[model samples]
Target chain A: MLPILIYGTTLGFTLALIAIGLSLVFGVARIINFAHGAFFAIASYTLYLFFITLNIPLPVSMILALISTATISVVMYIISLSRVRGMELNEMIITLAFTIIVIELLRIYFGPSPLGVPSFMKGGITIAGYVVDMQRIFIVVISIATLAALAFLVKKTRIGIGMRALAQDEDAAMLIGVNREKMCIISLAISAILAGIAGVSVTPIMTASLEGAWYALLNGIAIVILGGLGSLVGSLIAAFIIGYAEIIIATYVSSHLKSIVALIFIIVILILRPSGIMGRHHEIEERV
Target chain B: MKSRKESNKNIRTIRKERLDRGARARSKDLYVLMSYEDIAYVILPRVLPPLILLAFPFIVRDTYWHMVFFLAGYYAVASMSWDLLGGFTGLVSFGHSLFIGFGGYFTAILNVWYGVPIWLSIPIGTLAGAAMGTLIFAPCLRTKGVYFSLVSLVAPLVMVGSILAFAEITGGEEGIYGLENPLTELQWYYIMAGLVLLTFLILRKIAYSNFGLVLQAIRDNEPSVKVSGINPVRYKVTALFISGLFASLVGSLQAHKLSFVGPSYFYLSISVGIITMSVLGGVATIIGPAIGAYILTILTEWLRWLGGLRMLLYGVILLILLNFKPEGIYRYLERTYQTFERQVVEE
Candidate 1:
């Protein structure tokens, strides 16, 4: 039971990190950004290339991976977003294509085999009666620190205010002389950075592979649907629920049935409450 | 001087007459050109392609390539059926393979378990496919576009799970096989070719009819179509039923040809492949999906030699096409052909 708790907490942290970025993108951009998982995969591959192949230090490799992913995301936004402006279907298709392309490219480069990063912390730590890996504990701490930092930035900084305004109302934000384009670029960059951080942090615990993108995408979508598309607090809660549910289900039932169960939950939730648990039914007018 | 002035006036009159004649000739040419286009697009393909497809297997020898051709023909028919519902109706279904798989499995089970003849089992399978489509997806018509797609996607995954859980009947991951009678590959090829041609001709006739236009209208705007005194639901469901019919037929044929059936045959990847074919060919066009299926089928066969590179290349190509040419290769070809015609006319 203790081990399950630790596992659930670790899973929740990783999921939250991924979910926050998705939440931000959805809140501000109104685009589902299906390629977000692809970005995460790319970040993982970059870390693998740096640390495992080039013999670089893990910390330095992770920072570089984050930066690289951010750069790629910004570039992708410039290329795909320009055409998809104000069109939800177009945006979905374009992002779906992007995800496919990225996953395929990774498969071509790395083959179908899974790769892993060395755990940053080498030993296990005991908390109460349960022994947990130090790496998982580090992940939880880092995730908390990152979320706190993100909240502070959004609350305290001028850019954060601009982002908030943009999320609330784009036209009004523009009327107030907010640089909409710049803020959008910044939002995408930050979103990508968060995904990159999640990717690198979780790579040691969960090996990175082509299938990783699909797993991340499915979890992220479930969380967003359950939590509410643009709600950070809701995302955190949903992630915990999902993380715990998955752990418990896998422990009690067949592991293979976990995806089917999660999918059913999503379908049930969507049919019953499309706006999600905490989401409001607002007409989210997005310029793609 | 008087005689010179008279000659000049005569010359001017002759020039005027020549210009009038030229204008008349140009108008006549335009009429002829329009008639030719009507015959070529509306009449000729309607008549010729089906005839050619029917007689194709008779001309070709019973070789491995011929087997491939039969497979391609089957897919072409199935893909065209998909286009009717998905492309024309703007209802993108990712679980189309569910119908195909259902049809195949139903036919196989009927033949293997009950000793029913293959011919009797095929229609039953097709009807079962149509019923499944209506029961599972027709309710989703109440929802809008993306929601419908989401439901369809989940439905297939559920089906996959159910198939696995009920392994005793389904044969599970190991699959069900050896239901075919002893027939030559050539005979199978001809039989499939004949079915494909028949299916194509039927679909082509529907496409050129007023029903096709109404379906397109429904796709463009459901509320507007409703306001225009048409029941969108009826047309959508009809399109789905027709598509299901063809899917089941193909599935039945596939099961018979391979002498086996499996869950993988009806997997999400197959649905993706169908969508790719339809999109690559140009959605909503009659021949586009057939062409797309032919090209992609051949590409896939060739890519088998390259191992993992095939899937990687396939994914990359899909992305590039979606990004660069969303309307697909068929639309691109149509545009080029139009431009070429204009250039020829101007010259």
Candidate 2:
């Protein structure tokens, strides 16, 4: 039980890190940004390339990868997403298309096999007589710190205030001098960097592979939907719910059933309450 | 004002007009044919494409190329099915491979495990698959827009996991094989061509019919449809069932043709491929998606050497198409074929 608690919280934090970016993009831009998963893939793949292939120093490689990911995210917004801004369906398709391109390109360059990345701090620490990797513990601490920093950034910063205004009402915010396009670009970069952080931290545990795109994508979508499309708080809570549920299912049941938990959650939540747990957008409900 | 011909001569400006406009004006409220040109105009487009499709197998005669055409025809039929629900009814499904997977798996299980005859199992499997799709989608039909799409996108991923969990029955990663491909390549080709023609004509009829109009109205505005005394859910359900039927038919046929059914049948790429086809051909046009499917399928086959670069190409093309010609090629082709242009002077 203690093992489950420790592992679940770790997993939950990592999942939250991956999903918050997706939720953030959807909330501000009203775009699904399907390529968001590719952002996660891009970060880890670039990290692998720079650190392992180029022999760059570890810290610098990580920073380079994160910066490159942010640049690509903004470029993607300017190139593909900006053109089809409000057309919901086109945005989804173009982004999905972009994701396929990125993942396949990674496969072409990196080959299909998963590549191992060494952990930041070697060795494991025994907790309550069960040994846990130092990396997992590091991930937990880092994720919490990042979340707190993000909260402060969104809650108190001028950019955060403008982002909040844009999200709540785009036209009203525009009237008040918030730049819509600039906010979109900034939000996309921030979201991509967040995914990059998650990908970099978790790569040692999961290993980096082409499948990570789908993994990140499916989990991100699952959490975002269950948490409510645009609600960060809901995403945080839902991520933990799925994280703990997955760990418990894997522990008690067959490990093969792990991924099904998120999918099932998505289906059930969407069917039972389209507006989600904390969302106020009952507009999704059927009329008559 | 200058005379029309003089004005046209005065300015070297070009004016575009629909050639059909003249034919339409001539044929208004009448049962008479103006000339052979009129008869040719109406008859050629409708008849020529089907005739060419019917003769394609004979025209090609090569087994390898025949196989490619057969695959294209399968995508064509599936795209048409998708067009019915997504284009007409506005229920954009991102996981259409679910129906295809169900259809294939049902046939495989029925034939392999239950000892059912191929002929008997195909129809039963198709029906069962369609029913299963309808049942799964029925609950989410109440939710609008991306909610339905989200449910659809996740459902197939769930199926993949479930299949792996039930490895004893599903054959796990190796999938269920050893089923028979009883039909010859030529026979399969003809069957596929026949299905494409039948689906196109039938879906076209439905789209222009009163029932199809109601579905379109639901897509455009559901509340107005409700105010007009139509139950949008019922129409949507029927459309979904019909759409699922064609999609399942193609899946069952493909499974039998390949003599295999596997978890990969539910891959997201297939769904994305069909959506790309529908959008490229012109959404909501029953005939357009078929054309788009054939074009894309052939293009995919031709780019076989590119291998890894092929999907990248698809992404680029989709991006370019969505940015530049979101209306798709069929609409553009139709306009060019039906319209004529002339230079005219400004009045």
Candidate 3:
């Protein structure tokens, strides 16, 4: 039971880190950004290359991954944003295609085999006759710190206010000279950096591979759907719900059915409540 | 003598008039005019392309590679069917493998348990697929866009799970095999080729028809279609049913070709592959998906040397294409062909 609890917490924190970026992107951009998983996988793989292949220190490797992923996200935004314009469906399709390309490129270069980064903390802590790995504890800590930092940045910064305005109304924000494109780029960069940090933090525990894109994508989609499309708090809450549910299901039922079970939950939730737990009724205007 | 000469002249003129009318009717109805450019650019090239493709197996002489071509042909047909519903209708079903899997399973079961001949089982499977499509997707036509896609995606996953759970009938995860007919591989290739050609012709006709136009209308705007006095739901359901028919036919052919059927044949990735082919070929175009399928299949076969990197390549290429050429490769080819024809006509 203790093992399950630790595993659930570890998974929930990792998922929250991934979900926050997606929620931010959805809130500001109104695009699902299917390439979120690709960015995550790329960041994880970059960390693996830096730490395992190049013998870099874990902290430096993690920072490098975050920076590189941010740059790539900026490049992606520049390339796709103009073409997709105001069309959310086009944005979704373009991102889906982008994901395919990124994953394929990784497979071509790194050869599809799973790569792992060495755990930063080598030991564990004992609590009430139950021991928890130090790496798992680190994941939980970093995830909380990152989430707190993100919340502070969004609530207290000028750029965050601009992002909020843009999310509410792009044209209105532009009329006030909010620099919509710059804001979008920044949002994408922040999202990518968050995903990168998550990738680096979780790589030691989960390992990294080309196949990570689909798994991460599924979890991200499920969390975003369950939490609400653009609600940060909701995403955090939904991540835990899903993470715990999946871990519990895998333990009680069969591991192979985990994905199917999660998908079923998503379907049921979507049918029953499309707006999700914290989502409001949104008037979706036809953009294109 | 003067009256006889006059009558002969009149008779000759009347006969000549009749012959002229007959020739005109034949030319108008049967001998469609190929514009000089069309003759030079499209007609000449297309007429012999099939013959050339047919001659390929003869030249290669390797049965295994010929089998690969046959498989490619089947996939081309399946992908095109997917394009018709998902691309043209904008339904974006992620559960198309359900139709294909059902078709294969039904055909195998009918052929094995009931001793039904292969010829009779194929149509039965096709109808079953159409029925399943109506049952699953027709009701969801009221739901728009992502909702429809989400439902369709879940449908296949559920089907697979149900198939696995009911091991008594479906043969479970291990899959069903050993149902082979007495036909040789060469005969099967010919059968597959014939079916592919038939499917292509049928889809081309559908693309040119008013029904196809209505499907496109429904895709572009459902409310507008409804306001225009056309039932968008009916048209969407029809498109799904037609797509299912073709998908099932191809699935049945696949079962016959492989002499084995499995759940993997109807997995999510297969649906993803179909969507990839459809989008890569230029959605809403009749021939684009087939070309997309053929190119991807060949690319996949060649990239086998890279092991799992082929899928990665597929993803990357899809992204690049989506960014740069949302209209797909076929649109570019069509434009080039049109320009060449125009130039020939001008010359």
Candidate 4:
């Protein structure tokens, strides 16, 4: 029981890290970045390619992989999201379009298979009679640190302020000299890089594969939508709720039904309260 | 060399820039059919494609290409429904395979378990599909576009899980194989082709009618539509039913043709491919999805040699198409061929 609790918490934090980026992108850019999942997949894929396949140093490989994903995100932003900015349908369609392209590219190059990644840290420590890996602990630490840093960036930095301004209103932000395009590039980069880190960090636990994008896409979407499309606090809370629920389902029932938990969660929440737990009820009407 | 007589005659002959016969004919709606050219313009586009598609089996003697053509017609039907539901009706479904898979499984169950004949089962399955789809998605109509899409995106995934959980009946991952096909391969092709043409004509007529206009208005602004005394819910539900009916119809056809029904029909890729085909063909154009599906199915067959690169190129092609001309190939052609750009008089 304790093991399940510990595992669920770890899963929750990891999801928080991933969901935060997705939430940020949606909040600021007002576009659902479906290709965010492809970022997760390719980050781990490139990490595998650079670190193991090409025999590069681990740190260098990680940085290079993260950089590569960021580059793709920026390029994707310019090509796909930039022109269709502020329109929900166009944005969603373009992002889904890029997602297909990215996931397909991953499949073509990777032979539609899952590839393993060696652990960043080895060994385990017992906590409450549950043996937990040091790498899992490391992931928890990294996620928390990343979250802290993101909070700081958003609270204290100028670019972060610009992002917040843009999220609230693009025309107003531009009027205040926020540079909407620049803010978009920066926010998308951060979002993509966070996804990259989440994927790379979690690689030791799960083999990176083409379908990882699908998993991340669905997970991120379920979390963000349930927590309200653009609310960070809501996403964080919703992530834990969904994460624990998913883990519990996997543990108690069949793991095959884990995705169904998210599916059901989305449907239930969408039907019951589209604003989510912490979101303003009247921000956007349930019906458009 | 200019003469006063030539200038004066040219000015007089111009007659205040009156429209010639061809120009006048072009100005009138096709319904008028003012001349032979007008009749050709209206009838050619509608007749030629279907004729070519009907003649395809005879021309493409290769078994593989025949299969490709058959699949093209199948995909055309599905994408057309998607274009209607999404592009025209403003309900963007990210996982439309729910209807397709539902159609396949329900038809399979009805035929195999209930001893229903294939002929009877198909229509029954389509009706069941429509009813199930409308019942399930009708509530979601109250939600915004994103939430509606979210429900759609997960509906198939849920279907898969439920199917797997009930593996005893669903056949689970292995799926039910060797269902009956009532017709021979050639007959199936011609029949499917006939169904495809029939679907095209029906959908096109509906799209241009007052019903289609109301649906389009709801897509633009539901409140305004409601203010104008139309229930958006009724139209949205109807659109879903119509769309699901055809999707299910084609899906059942596919299952019988393959003699199998599997959980793979619930795959999101099927939905994605349909959307890609619709967008490539040009959304809202009644026949664009059909054209898009044909081109894509053939493209996939040709690109099979590329192996993994096939999908990469496919993705790239979609990116190019969506980014450059989201209206799709059919609409693009329609605009180019049908549109006139005569200069306006200053008055």
Candidate 5:
């Protein structure tokens, strides 16, 4: 029971990091970045390529990996998403297509097998007679730090305010002298970096593979839906809910049934409350 | 200098005009055919593709190409089904494989475990598959545009997990195998060709009908449709059921053709491929999606030598097409087909 609690909190924090990025992108851009998964996978793969394969120092490799993730996210938006900005369906398709390309490229180069990454530290601590690795603890700590920084960035920073303005009303924000394209590109880059941070920090424990893209994406989507589409606090709460739910299922139920929890949640939530637990979009319900 | 002036005058006098051949327009809405050429012009475009498709078996002697046609036929039917709900109705489902998988699995279970004959199992599976699809998707219809699409995308993932959890019945990754394949290759080919024509004609008929217009209206504006004394949900549900029927039919046929059924049937790639085909050929046009399916399926097979790079290239091509040719191939072809140029002298 203690093991489940320890693991669930760790999983919850990791999900919060990943999902918050997805929420941020969707909230600001209204472009469901299906390629957000690719950002997650690409960060880990780039880290693997630079750090392990190319013998770069770990810190530099992590930074380069994150930079590449940001570059890819921006490039993706400019090339495909920018044209179909307001067309919701087209945005989804383009992002989904981009995801396929990225995932397939990773598969081609890295092979389908999961690649192992050595943890940053090599020790364990015992809590309540349960063994916890330093990497898992690192994941928990880094996730909280990143999330707090993100909260500050959104709440207090100039760019973050621009992003918030864009999210609230695009035309109104533009009328008020907000740079829409710049905000979108910056928010997208930041979102990618957040996903990158999650990918880089957590891959050592989980191992990075092509499938991680889809797993990260699905979990991120599950959290976003549960929290409400664009609500940060909602996403944070929903992330923990899903994380603990996944861990508990893996612990007690058959591990194979774990992924279904999110999918089931999406279906049930959409059916019962399209706006989600903390979603303020009552218009969605009325449309239904 | 004198001859040059004459040539310029002639060029100015004889302006080229494009007109519909063999028909005289009485007004914007009415036309009278001046000759048999007009009748042929009206009928030929509608008939030629199907006639060519029917004649394909005789023209193409290679067994390998025949197999390719069979595969193309499966995707063709699937994409057309997608176009009905997605194109005509404006409900873009990202997990259409749910219907196909249900159909395939139902047939597999019935034939393998219950001793149901292939003849009975196929139709039963198709009906049951469609019914199940309507039931599962009915709840999701309440979700607005993007939300419905998202729910659809996730629904198949749930099916995949459930299959794995209930591995004993579903056969997990290995899936159910050794179902009956009583039909000969040619027989299967003819059936598929016939199905392609039947589905195309039927869907086209529906799309041009009053019912289809209502579906399109609902897609454009549900509230307006509701205000017009139409129940959008009823029309949407019927469209889903009809779409599922064809999707299920092709799925059951493919399962029988392979003598196997597996979780791969519900793969996201398959659903994505269907969407790609629909978008490529032309959404809202039954014939266009079929063409798209054939092109993509053949292109995929042609690029098989690239191995994993095949999908990467496919994605790149789709992205390029979506960006540059968002209107699709059929619309372009239709524009070229419906008009001809002739010289007319100005008085």
Candidate 6:
């Protein structure tokens, strides 16, 4: 039980980090940003190239990777996506295009083999006759700290307030002198950076690979849908629900069903209450 | 001076009336069948494409082109299905591969276990595919906006996980191989051609029918549709079922042609691929997606030399197409073929 809770929290926080960006993009931009997971892969690959291949210190390497990923997001928006800003279907398809382009390009460069980053810590702690790795504990700490930082930034900062305003009503925000295009750029960059950080943090645990794009994408979509498309708090809660749900399934049932658990959770939630547990019901009309 | 100006205005109005009368007469030429040109204009585009498609099997003798033609037919049929739900009903599904996958897997399973003949299994598999897709999506049919789309995007993925989880019965990762290829390459081509034509005509007929009107209404305004006493849920589900049925038919046929069914059949790429084909071909036109599918399939084949860059190329192409030609090639073709533009003097 102790082990499950410890490990589940670890999974939950990491999942939250990955999903919040997706939720954020959908909230503020009204675009699904299917390439959200591509950023995860890019971050993982970036971490692998730096911390593992180049022997850069982990902290320095992570910062560089996050910055690089954010830059890529800005360039991608300007080049391919800025024209299709409010067109929902085109945006989804174009982001899918970006996902395929980014992941495949990375695959060509890195090849298909999985690479691992060294854990931040190298030891374990035993509690209640169960061994808990220090890496897991460290991830939980890092995830919580990052999440707290994000919450603080969004709630307290001017840019964060602009983002919140845009998310609530883009036209209204624009009417009030918010630069809608700039907000999209900002949200996309931050979202990509957040996804990158999630990818970077999990590389040690999950082992970074090109397949992370697909897995992270599936997980991100599942989390956002269950938590509601644009609700940050709801996504956080859904991530824990899914993370612990999977751990429980893996514990008693079988690890094979872990992905299925997330999928089922999405289907069930969408069926039961499409607005999600805590999402606004009004914004649901324009999504189709 | 005033008499001269009035006389000039009368002359301009008389000339404009003469031009308008000529234009209206030309338009009535089609309905009245007054000339060979109008008759040819109306009949040529509709008849020629199908006639060419029918003659394609005989023209393509090479095994490679035969395979290409087969794939074109495959995408064409599937794209038609996608267009039905997405283009016509406005329920954009990204998990359409679930229907195809279900169809393929069930057909393969029935063949492996019950020794069912390929002929009988295909129909059963298609029905099963429709049933499975409908059941999976039924719960979300009443949900508003992109809720259905979101569920659909993940539906095939969930099926993939479920298939892999029950790999023991599902034959695991390699999927159920060693299945028989019941038809020769040429036979498969003709069969696919026939199937594509059949599916298109049926779907086209449905789209023009009263039922289709209701579906289009739902797409345009579901709340108003409900206000008009129509049950949007029932119509939406039926549309999905029909759409899934067609997709499954293609899937079942492809399984026999490929002689195997794998989890790869359920890949998200297939769903996106059909969507691209339909959008590029022209949405809302039952036949346009097939044309788009054929073009794209051949284009993909043409770019086969690019090796790993194929997907990157596909992504780039889709991005460009969506940005520039959101209405698709079908719309362009329909406009050029169906309309005659001439000078109209406004007075």
Off by over 4 Å in 3: A1-5, A87-90, A126-129, A284-288, B1-62, B93-143, B147-174, B205-211, B226-238, B262-273, B295-309, B336-347
What CAPRI-style quality would you assign to candidate 6? Answer: medium
lDDT of candidate 4 over B1-347, digit per residue (tens): 56988988665655443334344446654344867877787689768987887887777787777777888888899998888888898888888898999899888888877878898888998899778877777767765566677678767867887788778888899888877886777887887789888898899898889999998998888878889988888888888899999999988888888889999988977887888888888888868888889998888887787765655555666677766777788867865665555443442
Q: By summed lDDT, which 10 consecutive residues of candidate 1 chain B come out lowest?
A: B338-347
Tens digits of per-residue lDDT, candidate 1, B1-347, equal 99999988776655422123224334646442366663464356458767766666667654866877777887788888888877777777767887888888888888777777878877886788667766666654644455445456556656676677667787788778777566787888778777766776799788779998888887777778889888887887788788888888788778877888888767756776777787789878867888888888878887778765554555556656766787877887766543321111111
Steric clash pairs (candidate 1): A86-A287, A86-A288
Candidate 5 chain B: minimum summed lDDT over ten consecutive residues — where? B21-30
How large is the i-RMS for each model, in angstroms? Answer: 3.8, 2.7, 4.1, 2.3, 2.1, 2.0
| lDDT, candidate 6, at B95 | 83
TM-score of each: 0.82, 0.94, 0.81, 0.90, 0.94, 0.91
In the range B105-150, model 3's lDDT, one tens digit per residue, is 8887887667778888889977886687557655446556664564
Q: How far is B340's C-alpha from truth in model 6 (Å)?
A: 6.2
Model 6: runs farther than 4 Å from truth? A280-288, B1-26, B30-39, B178-181, B338-347
Q: Write the per-residue lDDT of candidate 5 for residues A34-76, one digit (tens) a residue.
A: 8888899999999999999999999999999999999999999
Off by over 4 Å in 1: A153-156, A170-184, A282-288, B1-45, B105-117, B126-142, B150-166, B181-184, B194-245, B266-268, B302-304, B332-347
Cα lDDT tens digits, model 2, B7-105, are: 776554545433554455466543325688767866788899999988887787789998998999988999999999889998888889999999998
Supply the DockQ value of model 6: 0.54
Candidate 3, true inter-chain contacts retained:
0.31
Predicted candidate 3: interface RMSD? Answer: 4.1
Q: Residue pairs in steric clash, candidate 2? A: B15-B342
Evaluate residue B253 in candidate 5 and report its C-alpha lDDT on the 0 to 100 scale.
Answer: 92
For candidate 3, lDDT tens digit of each residue in A151-239? 88899999999998877777898999898777878888898988888788888888898667766777777777677677888889988
- Report the Cα lDDT for candidate 4: 0.82
Tell me the deviation in Å of residue A268 in model 2.
1.6
lDDT-best of 2 and 3: 2
Best by lDDT: 5
